[model samples]
Each structure stands twice: as C-alpha cells, then as structure tokens.
Target chain A: MAMKERLTKADEAKPWYGELPVESLYTAGIAGEKFFRSIQEKGVFLGSKCHKCNMVYVPPKIYCEQDFEKLEDYVEVADCGSLESFTCVHIGLDGKRLLEPMIVGLINLDGASTSIVHMLGETTVEELCMGMRVCAVFKPKNKREGAITDILYFKPTKQ
Target chain B: MGNRVAIVGAGMTKFVRRAQETGKELCYEAAKMALDSCDMNLDQIDAVALGTAPDTFDGVHMKGEYLSDGAGAFGKPYMRSYVGGGTGVFSVAQGWYHIASGLMDTCLVICEEKMSSYRPHPQGAFLTIFDHTTERPLKPNLLWIFALEMNRYMSTYGLRKEDIALVAVKNKNNALDHPCAQIAKAVTVKDILNSEVLAWPVQRLDVSPVSDGAVALILTNETIARRVTNKPVWIEGVGWSLETSYWTNRDLCYPRYVEEAARMAYKMAGVTCPRQQIHVAEPYDPFDYKELHHMEGLMLCGKGEAPQMTVDGITQRDGELPVCPSGGLLGVGNPIAAAGLMKVAELFWQLRGEAGKRQIARKPKRGVAQAWGDLMQVGTVVVVGI
Candidate 1:
C-alpha cells in the first residue's frame, strides 16, 4: 500500500437528503373487521377459531397461518391473559431516550393459541413478571373507536 | 446437483455506521475487489445472484433491479433473492444452484444494504415488518422481539445475564483483529451488564450497529474454480428453511428453523455429526444471545449447552470449535444481507489461510456460515471447505 499526502484544504461538501413521502391505508378483512368491531362495540376481545387445527388466533386473521384454512367462525375470549414475555423499552425510534420507559408484553389471551403484542400499563416494569395475569383496560364505551387504540392498555388484574 | 461449485474469490467494504458511497457505488467497489482478487473480469461471469434485505432500509423499492448494473449484471441473467436478513447466505445458495444446476458456469453473488438511507433510524423501517393488522397496533420496535426471545431463551435454560454477556465479550474482542470490523473493542461481562438497556435483557451493546456496506463473492463450477485459483473454497452444501410468519405461536426458546436448515446442509455434505465434522463456525449474532441461540440451533451443541460452552472459553477464537472468528454481526456491523455474505467471505479467507491476525490457530478445513431473518422466520446455511 502507498501513502499520499493529505489535502490541506478540504473539498466543498455537497449533501442531499431525501425522504419517501408515502402512506398506506389498509382495510381490515372480515375476520379483522369482526375482531376490532367487537372490541369497539362490545368492549370484549374476539378470536378466530381454526377448527381443523383447534387453534384460536387473538386479533383474529381470516386464514390460519398453520393450515392455510380460512377462519370464518369467531369466538369470544376473556379480556384477561397471562404474560408470555415482556420488555421495557428505553429508547425511542428517533434514537433518543423515551420520555419514560414503556413496558411491552406478549400476552397469551385466554382461550387463544397465539399471543398478542401490546402495552403494559398501570404497573411498574420492575414488578412485571412472566405468567402474571393481566386484563385489558379499554376506553369508555362512548369513547371507543373501531381501532386497536380502543383498548388503552393491559393492566395487572387479580385472579 | 448438476455440477460441483466453489467460491473462487470474495471481497467486502469496511463495515461502517454510514458510508459516503451510494448503494450502487458500494456494490461496484466490492464487485471490483472480488474480481481483482481472483484476477477475473466481468466478461467471464455467466450470471449474477444478488441478495439484499427489505427495500425499506435502502429506502428504494426493487432494490435488486436498482443495484444490478453496479453489481456487473448488465444484460446478464440476473436473479435476486430476499429472505429478510437471511438473504446473504441465501444468495450464496442461489448462486450455488446456478452453477450446481449447470445453468451457469460462473456466477457473481453480491449482497448489499444501505441502512443509513432510512431516516430517523433504520429501525423505523423495521416497524412495518410486523403484521399491519395485529402486531403494529401496539407500536413495537425490533428490539422488543429480540428481548422477548432472549427472555424466553434465558428463562428456559435458567441462564444468567453474565453468562449470556460472554458472547458479546468474545465476539467484540475477536473483532479487534478484523480489517473491516466496525465496533471492535475489548469489553467485559460487567461492562455489558452495566450498558444502557434498550429493552429488558437487551442492552445497547448486545445489538449490532446499523451499517452501510456491501460484500461480493465470485462462485464458479469446479472446472472454473480449479482453473481460476490454486486455493478454491468449495461450497460443499447449501440449506435454507423458513418457519411460519406467526412468530408468536412458536416457542422462542429455540430456533427450530436454523436446526432444520443445518440438518439439510449437513446431510448434503455427508456429515452425520456437526460438532465433529465442522471445524470453524460463523453463526449469526445480531444480538449477543442470538449467537448462542443459533449455535444450539445449528446443533453445534445440545440445547442449553451453548452458555456453558461460552463459560468454558470453548467459543474463543483459539478454542477447539471457534465460533464467529470473523467477529460476526455483533462485533462487525449488521447491514442485514451484507453481514451474512461477510461470514461466507471470512470462511473463504480462513480456509485459504488469508485471514491474517484473525485466522484460527488450527488450520481447519470445513466451516459453516448461517443467518436468520424476518420475524424470526427464515434460516440460511452454507457449508464450505478447502
């Protein structure tokens, strides 16, 4: 390898920053629409039962990821669930410290074979434990929207 | 298989958090260096196999088509494969089929990722990787999934954080000798334990850095490999497997997909026992715990045996079964696809006795490189030897 003298004067800097101005809107399919509308209208959780596989999906999908069978029958699930896994996030997406750490958990909702990822609120991260029973805290019936935000967060609940 | 295939040459750019070069420029640099290494020209290449992660990171859709000309694929039979993070070794597999199936005598495989193009943070692009209907509603980040998996793995094995931290300590230290290492440094278990936590059980140090880099490998049939170079590294076997997209349904403690992929590759390579047959190994380590997870997944050791192996210093660069002698994604940078090809390239150097200070003390012959990607759904494995 050969070495060359460094330029005493730096070259002019020319920089360009571009962004992709894009947005996406999705229509919740039959199963998804039923899953969300149930939460919004009834303040209750709904799941799709795949009778062939005997598997229930929380936040239901139209088809079973396992058997590829369409899931048409919807079943009601209890708001309470057991925490399968949890994480306390301290960093924000913008590479900054979050205003406050958030506790996120994967909860296996009652009667569902698959877990749902959601926020854990009304409890301290240090106090969070795997297998802890928690219940969804939903917005008031009059204020509920037909979106995931209808359920404000999950909180520790006494069995 | 139609014809035996081997890697004739490999090249990579320095792994960095950001690069001044564009994605095309990076691809050209790595391709040129790889061609130079084997004293071969683009005209000799019969096909091109390009591997890259999501277009989200590059902020460009159809990343393969956009990057083709710079990869020396102008007017050539070019194909691209995407398996999220597994695209690296998967590209090698794609090229292997090109030569092994007799469709092409010589194939140039290139993997590149320009993660720096994604603003705010490259990880922002990862948010949409979750199911738009269900998982995205919670506003989750990628680290959350890793943490959840790490927690499950640790809880199942009854392992301590200190024991898991050993992977970071070992890999980062080994990277000090790598020419393209990005965050190479000496660290201790105490340092890792004290590092700021990005997610519970996952600290800032546990993760690989966001990187912008490219890696290229020239693969050819046995005849061309023997004719082009005196020390050709034969790709003895290739295997890839994908788990269900329903990540939540599976037990996160073990990566069954990696094990299945390794089993297929090992069977093809005629190796009954991975632990005894494979000499040097490069398991993916995007997070420190992932190294151990993949080690077990690769069947290098029994389930829960990896932590003890780490404690026994068996995973050290000079150990009996040296893992990640290339510094891995953790010590090097994780440009997704590029990071995986870098491991294959490292195996080439190690087998060819050209790894310099990072070479294993024992001149081993056989090696394996594996990568995992996408909602923890896919595993890509490649077996190579001198």
Candidate 2:
C-alpha cells in the first residue's frame, strides 16, 4: 500500500478585502413605493398588523411571523415614534472611506408595535435615546414621487 | 414515528481558497460523490434539500434556483432554507424532517458555497447582514462583532488570548489528516499571536479562510438504512431556533438561542446531561473565539469554563469531549453552508470508525453538531446516535 500523505499547510498571509460598485438613482418596488408615498405626501407611514397575535410590523410585511398568516390591508401609523436603538457608523463596507459619520436608528413607529429601521439625522449621538420621540422628515414635494428616500431622515421633534 | 432517518452515506469535494467550478458544478460533484458512496443513483432519491448561506457570497440572487439542477432537484419536491452559517445543518435537519414526517423515504441533502465569487473581499458581503441604515454606517467588518463578543467572553471569564489560540493550533493539527483541508497547518501559540490583527482579539489565523467547496449526505429511513449498512447513524433528534433580528439589544457574551435549541434537541434525543453523554461535538467556529462561545452555549461546560477546559486539552481527540474532530472550519475551510454539513459528515465517519487517522480514541456512542448564523442570533442543533 502507498504511504498516506498529510495535507499541505498554507503559507503567505494575505489581507482580507472586497469591492462593490456605486450607482445613483435606484428604483423601489411598487409596494415599497406606495409605502413611501404615504410618508412624503401625507406624513403618514403604513404597516400591517397581525390580527392573530396583535403584533404590529412597521414598513408593512406581507406575512406575520407568529402564525405565518398573511397580513390584512394597510394600517396607517403616526408620523412620530420612539427610538428603540441607534448606532453610529464610521466606515463603508465597499472600502470607500467616509468623510462624515452617519447615524442609523430603529424607530418604533407610533400605533405600530414593531420598529422601522431608518437614518437618524441632524442629531448628536448623545442626544439620541431609547425613548426619545422623533418624527419623519420628508423631501420637498417637488422632489417626492413616492419612494423610501422620500423620508431622508427622522429628526427629534420638539415637545 | 413511521421510520427513523439515518445518514448512510456522505461525500465532499476538496475545500480550496478558490475553485474554477461554478457553484452548480460544485454541488454536482459533491452530490455525485454522496450518491456513489451509497452505491445509489440520483434517480433513487425521493427528494432533494439544498442549503446555502447568503446570496451575497455567490454574487447570485435566488442561489437556490440556480443550484437546483446541479443538486438533482429537477422535477422533484425541492425546497431551499437558510439560517446564515447554520444553513448546512439546517439543510440536514430539513432532510430529517422529510423522512421523519413520512413525506419522503429517501432524500439527498446537499450544501454548497463559493465565497470567492465576491470580488475584492468576502467581508464586503457581511455589511448587508447588519441593520442596513444604522449598523452599516459604522463601517464594521464582520470581525468587529466577533471581536466585541470575544472581548466580552474574555472579560467575563478572565481568559487569556493564548488560551483561545490553542483551539486554532488543535484544529489545524487535526486537519493534517483531512484530505479536504484548505489551510491545515501546524500552528503554534506564537504563530497565532504573531499573525496580523483584524479586529482586536481576533487575528487572521484565528479565522477560517473563505473557501469554495460542497458536501453531500444521503438520508434514508430505518428500513432502508438497515438494508444498506450494518452500522447506521440515526438522526435521533434535531432542533432549530431563530432569535429576534435586533442583535445589539441582547447580550453577546452567551448564545441563549443555542442553549434553547440544544435543550430542545437533547430532550428529543433523551440526553439528560450533554457533557457526559455526548462523545463528540462540532460547534460552529467561523472564528476561533466562536468555537468557545458555542461550546458554552451547547452546555458542554458551565458558563465561563470552556476557555479553561480548552486550555487543559479537554477538547482534544484524546480528551473526554473530542470537539471538531473533522479539523473544523478554522482549519479545514469554510464555505459557509458546506462547513456546517462537513461537521455532520465528520460525526458520521467518527461513529462508523471510518475516520482513518483523525479517529478519536474512544468509541463515539453519540455526537452533537451545531451551526449559528444571522447576526449571531439563529442557532441550529442536531444530535446523532450510533
């Protein structure tokens, strides 16, 4: 029988890397556009609430996770919501260095139970808190045509 | 149950940093090998279950459809499922469900991943896994999350960096006998410490290399299993659970999801105490520290004790619990979905006494394999008995 040989070891330590192309003017799906239009035109966000468990999902989902049942028609949500969690991002995944840091937060939209993830702008990291109330900011009517980008960011509302 | 499901045969392609074969071809190679191992053909399979990780790794959307024909799912009851790196074991669990549920008597379970397809770096795909609007802006690589967890683990247990490096050394050494290993090296603590740092506490050597490969298994019910082989490994129990996607809101030091899943599986398998009853374990180890993280989660040892046990050689092949006898993802290679199934295949071989040089000294009566994925939240567990 031939002698058994062991596997060879790998040499040459190499740095890990990845690349992605950047493009402007992306399109949102029809359903996604409809949801965004409500925010831009009426300052109202919509989501589907599960009748089975009373679990609300913001940025409406087609199906409910609790019962795996299809959701009912759209339910309008209040423009203001509480900040559930937030993070400050400093680096870009595409290896594209960023000039300024960006703040992202999960907002628990009012009248809906679940939090909707979106950009939190024009606020300092210290000013953001879990229970802080904030309202969605929409783009100018002339620039809005029903899209997620219609709400550029959510800013803290003055009580 | 009508019939008990067992994995009768398994096969894997060579794991490599890169492979010229397309993702479909890799699946075909492994599926063909698995079929050949059982002295069976694709036509004999009652169904097919395909498992793969993120679509970003392969640079193809709906990768399951692209891989269907190659996985021998053409015109068959086919379904694709994923739970991040847990996908491979989750695939096998789905196969077990089909056989146990009596929907199909025989199933071909195949898992394939080709991370090299993502140009520049595989790490880029990881950005999409985080909270897109919030976490993505931080520019954190996947390693940062693992590093944060590792730091927490170290602080909680007072463990040293060298203690964790031993896992890399042990797994890599174990890979010496594995034919499919991609970066199997005889590493030392110094070498690991000297390796380039990615995120603090996580070094280059501590992580598994991004690889391309596939692993396949043939699962059949008890009647068919007995007819095929004298010693068949039965899928005694399988369990999987997914935590809320809000990862940062929870503690990262311990994986409660894994503990829940393991408890469910152990209950079904009639295992009262895992540390004494389970002979082998293959917890997901994409990063060196993660192996320890998962070890504690599997309840192999009490919280804050795995790192100490690992340093004492308690996890070696000769130790009481021979963890990662297949060399693990840290040394063998990580193709995401394939790595998880590869651990199951290792347990199958160890239980059968067919592992050759990597075989454990003690007779493995029972084994447990687990995979974790999805922002470090989802956990999938499987327990096999000989």
Candidate 3:
C-alpha cells in the first residue's frame, strides 16, 4: 500500500473543521404516536394489551416484543401509580450545573406491565419514599401539545 | 462441506422517500411477511441474522439492539452483521452458515435501511465516513468519489455518457412493472443527458434516490426446506471482499474487490463460465454506471463491454440475459442494505416464477446478486438457484 506524504510543517498542514450541518425530525413510531397524541389531547394515559400474550405495555406499542404479536387494543390506565425508584439530577444536557436539583423517578402506572420515567414534583427528597402513590400533573389545555412534556410531572398523591 | 441451505420465504416493503414507521417497525413488517409467505410461524424460526446501514444514518446508537425484537430474534440466537451496502447480501450468507453448520434448522435473515431518518439529507451522514484527517479536510461526499470513479470508467473504455444512460433508461422502464418501486419511469437517453448535474459527469437521473425499506427471508436446511415449500431457492455460493480505504491509490476504472468477491462465489458454486452458466444477474446500481462496472467485475461481460450489451437490449426482461428484472436500485430504490437484499429476493421470486408482472420471459435456473459499498471499498456476492 502506498502512503501519502506526511506533513513536514504545521504551516503546510491547514486543517478544515466541519459539523454534520443537518437537522432531523424523528417519528414517534406506530406506538409512540398513539401514546403521545392521547396525552396531548385528553391528558389520558394509554396502554396496549396483547390478548394472546396476556401482557400490557405502558407507552403502548404496536406489537408485543416478547411474543411478537400485533397489539392494537388500547386501554386507558389511571394516571396515578406507585413510585418504583428515584434519582436527583444536578447537571443539564449541555454539561452545565443546574440551578436547582430535580427529582426524576420511575413510576409504574396502574394496570400496565412496565414503568415510565418522569420528573417528580411538589415534594422534596426528604418527603419522598419508595412505593408511595403519585398522580400525573398535566399542563394547561392551551399549552398542551403531542409530547411527553405535556405531562408536567408526577406528585405525591393525597392518600 | 456442510449441509445445503435454501431460501423458503421472502418479503419486502415498498421503497419510499419517507416512512412513518420506525426502523424496528420496518423490520417487523418484513419479518412477518416472510413468516406468513411460507405458512410458518415465528416459533419455527430458530435463529436470526440481521443487517442494515450503519447507525450514523439513523443517528441512533446501538441500533442493532433496538431492532433485535423487531427482526424476531427475541429469545433466539440473534446476530447483526453489516458491510455497508454489502450488508443486505451478507446477512443471507450469515443465515446460511447457521443452517449449514447444523446448529439450527431454520434461520431468518433481514436487511433494512431508513436513510430518511438522517434528516436535512441522508448524505450528511456520509461526511463522517471519510477519513476525518485526510478526506474530510477536502469535504468530499459520496458523489465526489463516485463521479471520479465514473469518469475513470468512461475514459478507460472510451465510452460515452449516452452509452451509460441506456442502463438508467432500461432499469427505470423495467421498474414500471415492479410492485414496490419508489420511482419507476420511462426516460430516454436524451432525458438522462439533459438532467441536472449534481457533480460533473454524474447527473440526477444517473443516480438512484434515497429510500427507506426493509427485506426479510427465511432460510432452512435442505430437509426442512423441502417441508416448508416445494420451490426452495438454494443458496449456492456467497463471497465478499473489501479494498483499501485510501481510494486515491486504487485504480478507479475497475472494482478489483468486486471481481475477487465474484470469483469466490463462482468457484464455490462450480461456475466456470459465468457468462454462459449464470442465467440472470442483479448487480448493485447505486449509480447508472455502477451496474455496467459491476457486471464487468462479476465477469458477466468483458471489461468495458457491458455498455454494448445494454445497447443491444441483452439486459432487458425479454432479452437473452435479463438483468435487474426487479428494477434494481436504479429503478426501484436504493435503501442501502435493504436494496441489496431486494436483489436476492428478486432472484428468488424470478426463479420460482412468482414475480407477477416483473417476471422474466425465459426460464432462468440460476442467478447472481451483488452489492458494493463503504467508501467505494467492499464487494459482496451471492448466487441463488432453483
């Protein structure tokens, strides 16, 4: 194999800098469209049930991953559920320190087989406890759109 | 040396400019169709082999894992293999080994690509494929390399652009008969010469469009294949080769790697006379000139002679040696790996006389499918027969 000549001086080697220079719009997929749209329009939670597999998925999908069965049956699940886990985040996506620590928790919605991660609100770490019930807090009707952020956060439910 | 492998089922989605389905969903549609085509359930499939374009195109990390369940590899021996464009054909070879080694009686092979996910344009992802220090400094895209290669091929044989335009004209016209074709139209050589020039010597009509689609096939050993379907297409031979990344050093006129890959597959299948023995061919045609270039490399025709054959109508559906009866990447679409496997699927459909309107006039017994990709480097070849 023949190798190209190496640069002998820094001045001789002028490097070029570039970025991807492209933006993208990804679809939420067959399951995600139904999942997000329902939240955006009605503030209701939807789950897909597979009759053959006897399983239900929160953030409902088009098919059952384990059984490979088509899942088109959508059922409404209560917005309130139990907290499975929690974490405190101190940094932002851009690698900067956040002004306030935010609580993120994984909550298992009632009547769903899986859990969804979301922001925890209206409570401090000192008051938060595992297995405690939490209810979803949706954004105002006018500000609502088809996205995960439509559900502002889950707060400790008055039990 | 090992148990023979045969393809029992095949399916594909329509190639399109954009698809609302995610990559995983694309895999599911194809996989489901393949299983249904052979009257078999997913439970009977023992293992899975998958191939697709690199993760860069979709901007998704660990894409193989994300698509695992979609390809029906859940709780099964699943493996992902990709050689850029060669990925589609190579996945079949991977599935063949699973059954041939007796490790599994049946294997499902899938190939998919969704270039539309790359946004603004899929070509942006190609910028990173270049050597960051060397080629990237020049800001060279895929078209730059292909344009350079096309010029070399044309000059080497004293061929004219009008001569190469016949391939585009023929393939697009043939694709009018294809069910899954994205943009199949009838155009004259004059139309090709008059199209907008993206790069010199490489016009808009001279290239295949960006597309999103997927294909899947079920491969089983001879014994199981006989039970699945009576018309099983055997995987006679499989071969792949990759050249150096430094495209500057290599001769641009001919694809040496493609020749080597074709020779390996031909030798394995005992094909001493490729031109005479191979009944049909489906060589990669991302660019109009690539079909002719690969035909020469595959030894289907003499170097620089593919143009004359095209002029003579020998590559048409009713001609003596029909090429790209499924419309190929040029006429149908180029979804990277999916397009490559699409050729293999075409061979299977043609061999079984199941290609509906796209069926060839002659009774072809054997066929070859080839794909080239990755920085003008790798070549993958597969030979299938009835």
Q: What's the i-RMS of each model?
A: 18.4, 13.9, 2.0
- For model 3, how does the per-residue alpha-carbon lDDT over B114-137 read when each residue is reduced to its tens digit? 888886788887888888877787
TM-score of 2: 0.71
Best by DockQ: 3
A-chain TM-score, model 3: 0.85
Error of 1 at B30 (Å): 0.5
How does model 1 fare in lDDT?
0.88
lDDT of model 2 at position B137: 62
Model 2, A12-112: lDDT tens digits are 43324443432222223223455767777786888877887787767765445333345656789888989899999988988776788889998988899
lDDT of 3 at B242: 90
Residue-wise C-alpha lDDT for candidate 2, range B1-386, written one tens digit per residue: 33689999999999998876667767877887887888877667899999999888887789999888668886789988888889998998999989998889899999999888876788877877776567766777788888888898888878899999999998998999899999867999999999999899989999999999999999999888888878889998888887878877888788999999899889989899999999999999888888898899899999988888888898998998999988999989999999999999999999999999999989998999999998888899999989
Error of 1 at B180 (Å): 0.8
Q: Per candidate, chain B TM-score?
A: 0.99, 0.98, 0.99
Q: lDDT of each model, Cα atoms only?
A: 0.88, 0.85, 0.90
Candidate 1: deviation at residue A147, Å? 42
* Stretches of candidate 3 exceeding 4 Å from the true structure: A1-18
Q: Model 3: per-residue lDDT, tens digit, A1-159?
A: 767787789888676656776666677888888888899888899999999987889988777878778888999998999999999999999999999999999999999899999999999988889999999999997898888999999999878
The model with the greatest lDDT is 3
